[model samples]
Target: MRSKEIVIRDVEKTFQTRGGAVQALSKVNLNIEPLSFVSVVGPSGCGKSTLMNLLAGLDTPTGGVIEIGGERVSGAQEGNAVVFQRDLLLEWRTVIANILLPFELHGVTWLDRKDRTTNRQLAEDLLRMVGLEGFGDKYPFELSGGMRQRVSICRALIQRPTLLMMDEPFGALDALTREQMMYDLLRLYDQYKCTVVFITHSIEEAVFLSDRVLVMSERPGSVVRDIKIQLERPRNLSTRMDARFLDCVKEIRGVFQSQGVLAEV
Candidate 1:
């Protein structure tokens, strides 16, 4: 087996609010292997976003530590990329230009100026891979929510980061669109083979998308269970009908139910 790519060691995070000190995460330990897809499910205000922020170095932990590829995470590393719920595209830039934003911001002037042809080709290829080939010249407003999010995914991948962090990236889309995006993401994961740490509240989504699902308890959130999904890959809607998938959902649902966080269905 390959060595762990990301490790969170007894990690804890706290925030000081007007009310008092807020404990966001407590003793959260995780080991994510390379090229694996993991989803974290938790209740609202259960520190799911906080955990992502810590990993991204957007915020520092009050205690413990997080390591990426054996290096302590002080700030965002070059090997990681993040896609948030919102597309966060530059409204003024065309789709292809938006996909090229990271390389430009990183000051790769060679790619930015004299030899932009290669970068442009790469952007075109990525847009095509994400089903936005002909739409590359279109502005963000011209695309649908799913199409815009596909562009966002392309932008995240443009850097070819080893670790990808997605925080409720499909939460804003409608149910059908979200499901389609899930399949698209899986296809992308198959191609890139990058480690993914996905954050979401939906039990069904978590079960469908993860190699492992970590269930978190309420505020002062902690990992209550880490369930490895043994479902076959190249998963589609049919996988959801399998007994194993249903069992996994039921088991995860039980975890949330025990914590009084299961969504009323």
Candidate 2:
């Protein structure tokens, strides 16, 4: 099946703090095209993660509606998958076992590493897709931060979810590792063709990996600018240096600066 379209209309989220009701997002509306790579970039407290949680159905919106493939997002759907900054891998499980964990939750009859199930094959294929072909037997403790994240990516994709929501998945990696991981993610995204909504604070990373970039305002986070990245796809690390890419990054940062969320260096 193809990726599902996402429609979010007039979404609002508020939290009841001891001080008062703190509104995180207000009057937000979005329509995400199917199979597109989109990224949301904003200031630290701009409710980017909150919006993702609502879209993923992990939390309910205070107002407005979120729909995926014409179905209202009332709760977690099998067609939807989410990846957070943390890998959340099971320390006791091997790499392949971690990938198959989602399948095991669905109560697939055959989940054993020794079993030759199609599910296991899919898990193995995903690991190989991310260039971890021979790391299946290694435990998460034995892998580097980036390798562990790759395993988590494989785990998220093992079921072939149509809508993949990732919240700062590579935030913790070092500069070189993060750059390589971004490349790896783009490669997997091309092959999987899933509709991805990525939330990040890095403007350049947003421009490099996204087909369209959404810039949000601070506090009451709403998309203030929907910038289309015109850079040629199959983007590599060098794409970051392209003139158009830099322009997009600058434009996003400018928006933040205008909002007082960022300032001159």
Candidate 3:
């Protein structure tokens, strides 16, 4: 599962708008080790998601190259899955069916009986992993916001992707639900051990779940700091109150303050 090494070299992106070209990223370089959890944080409109899109193969860099597993990224490839803020579940589909949708989209069907059976079993296991075991027969409308995101996470994991790109996956939930989801996500990360590149605005959230937090500059965003989280793993709600966690939060906040991005926080 830790077979891929993400190498982003001298990446740049310029988007064409009605006014003129808007340079979003410039001379960005990143090297994500295999099986590491990395979070990206910066001000609004600072190309954080733009960088993620490039890594996910949804958009191309105007310059430089991105390589995963030592292969140049030309388009969306297997072993890469994305989860956004929204659940994006099929309302008509049952919970298990929604989780199984990826297999169908990838063209797995009854013809490959063995693979299909194995994947079905894996789906059930993932549902249990995310604490949604008995809800498989339920529909998305029947579940709460947190439960829906849990299904979304299970759907992403069903692909067995080596790299999981998440853009604010829990941004929509309330505070309590969001806190619960964070712990649940850590459990999933411990089990899966895949490389994760997460984008978020919450400094505390980034510090809680990440092995390293990459901070970007303002507009035309570039990596300003890559701070390693010193807190031990198997972290929980109590970990947030630790002295080191508070220190890490303050350190990242200082970077933002220097950039005049403190007004938003």
Report the C-alpha lDDT of model 1 over 99-161, residue by residue, as the tens digit: 989988887686346547788888898888887879988999999999999999999998887
TM-score of each: 0.95, 0.96, 0.95
| Cα RMSD for candidates in order | 2.1, 1.7, 1.6
Prediction 3 global C-alpha lDDT: 0.92
- Show model 3 residue runs off by greater than 4 Å: 112-114, 263-265
- lDDT of residue 256 for candidate 3: 90
Error of 2 at 186 (Å): 1.0
Candidate 1 worst ten-residue window by lDDT? 107-116
Model 2, span 98-164: residue lDDT tens: 9988877886656454554677778888888888888989999999999999999898888788989
Per-residue CA lDDT of model 3 for 1-265, tens digit only, reads 5548999999999999999999999999999999999999988889999999999999999999999988999889889999988999999999989999989987887699998888879999999988888898898999999999999999999888899999988889999998888899999999888999999988999999999999999989999999999889899878999999999999999999888888563
Rate residue 22 of model 3 by lDDT.
99
